[model samples]
Target: MINDGLTDSKFDQRDGIPDAQKMSRAPTVAIIDIGSNSIKLLVARSSPNNSGIEVLYTHTIETRISSGISQAHPRLSAQAIEAGTRTVTELLRLARAYQPDAVRIVATSAVRDARNGQEFTELIETQTHYRVDILDGPEEARLIARGLATDPELSTLNDYLQIDLGGGSLEVILLQKAQIQQAISLQLGAVRLSEQFLLDREAPIDQNTASAIQTHVRKTLETSIDGSLPSLPVVATGGAIVITRAILAAEDGLTIENRSACMTMQEISQLRQRIGGVPLHDRLAIPALPPARADILPTALLTIEAVLEVANADQLTHSFHNLRYGIAAELLEKR
Candidate 1:
């Protein structure tokens, strides 16, 4: 029997365990990631380790609250802001219900870009009794690195290039020998790019728009990457990558293993064409793909393609992990 808060008996009773019993461990924590396109919440049972921690029990909500912020304005819309508050309120209720040892609420990209971000933070805490902290680009990059290194599936890829594309900002981190070597944050993402380049379009991804997106993504990557890039494997995670997999499956019944896999530039370009060609309504009906994400898929694919081009990576692997995993990993590490 494990001597920690849980036991072999508890493990045996898992099938019939009550919620309260499941949450009996100490240092239960919740990591709330308020992103530009999504607001994700994760409450996990944590176990401390010399390196970091372990986590279980996670959830996500693709709220897209910061959708289209780069061009529309550097601030969140009232509707978006209110939606964020509501989402957090619900998460707080869940955290309370679970009675975690602690809870950490954080806002990224959208909040960082918003002029009224501080005000929104106060509102969330005042109304929900949860304090919200905003992480800048560099910090965001580092936390993600730690998360990738700690994940059981990804831990094996000692050398890898990680891309996390969100609503307002995209973070890229490089790892070698299981340690972070370089990282950068780009002002490019699916929501804003879609608003800037495709809000009025209805045709499949055309050469003109695809070229423009590819150019922008390349330029951004060039600016961010300094020195020589290692021949590390490219691993991508986040809503955009997940959606891309769904599109690939739609085209050829391709099954993604939820881990980083090799993808060619030509294959990705063909995928871009196929995804852009589909109507928004058609995207909404695709199984495993979220309806709210229908319109943003094109823009997300564009950014991803550009990143691949700049990295000059031969292939990319997709992971089911995202910011929530990073947040949960950090919370557990703290204990």
Candidate 2:
């Protein structure tokens, strides 16, 4: 659960305003997400009926704060911390322009797994005056599941497997009857795996390295999961997945907005093969692929492919509603 202290309380102190009046009004919230690869801002207002969120703005800045995360005693580098702080400050400033009633900043796998994560958060608080919530693995998974439930299309599904892949960790959630049956976070993130297995991210991944990554992912999933994953629909959300979708859309001469949300295992495999055969510089030439993510995108695709095999699912539905949306919904509901 999100901390009570993080909830909006500005409405509680209206001198002459009645509690009912305050409760009846919609509330706007800003959520700043500090991830291993990027920092994102989402400013949204709840509908009067509290049924949906209307997004006012969204932005992202890649800060790759999880560099060196594959080390035995992983620590955030000084350069990464500085870049992260600067980006967070800028995003916070932008988020405040909408006059949000409440603002929440949360950090995921990168900060939680780092040895000096406290140092990074302290700097942000001292400079920005907003405390960052460093979520543990299970709690992060839970919040992701909560966020996914907010999607109207996804809400109709009674059972499915959800995967949220990030730079530092991969969150896996199994939903049965629209309730979470299992939620776990693994160290199978793209950045983490690239650092661990790929000697040269700038170059194309050779067959041996690709095989090694697949093997590691399969073993990790097998060890973490008690038994075989049920054959349910799979849903994925993350920067990598979004980029993959965009690339596919571009290849088919269609805009990302017009592209289908569902992706098949064969499509993913083909994309991985094509993308993995090229070096980072060559990949940057591809449309809709972000340069910052070019190096690790191959590893990300590999990870996603392995996950699908483990789940015995051939296709995955991509959801734009993620952790921030989930947090935003919570804030609005409290109001």
Q: Count the backbone clashes (under 3 Å) in each candidate.
A: 7, 0
lDDT of each: 0.72, 0.88
State the TM-score for model 1: 0.84
Tell me the TM-score of each prediction against the true structure.
0.84, 0.93
Model 1 is weakest, by summed lDDT over 10 consecutive residues, at 1-10
Candidate 2 stretches with Cα past 4 Å from truth are 1-25
**lDDT by residue for model 2 over 185-234, one digit each (tens)?**
99999999999999888899899999999999999999998678999999
Name the top lDDT candidate: 2
**What local lDDT does model 1 show for residue 182?**
84
Candidate 1 residue lDDT tens string, 192-277? 77777774645566678878977988877886788767767888877777777766665566655532355666777776676677
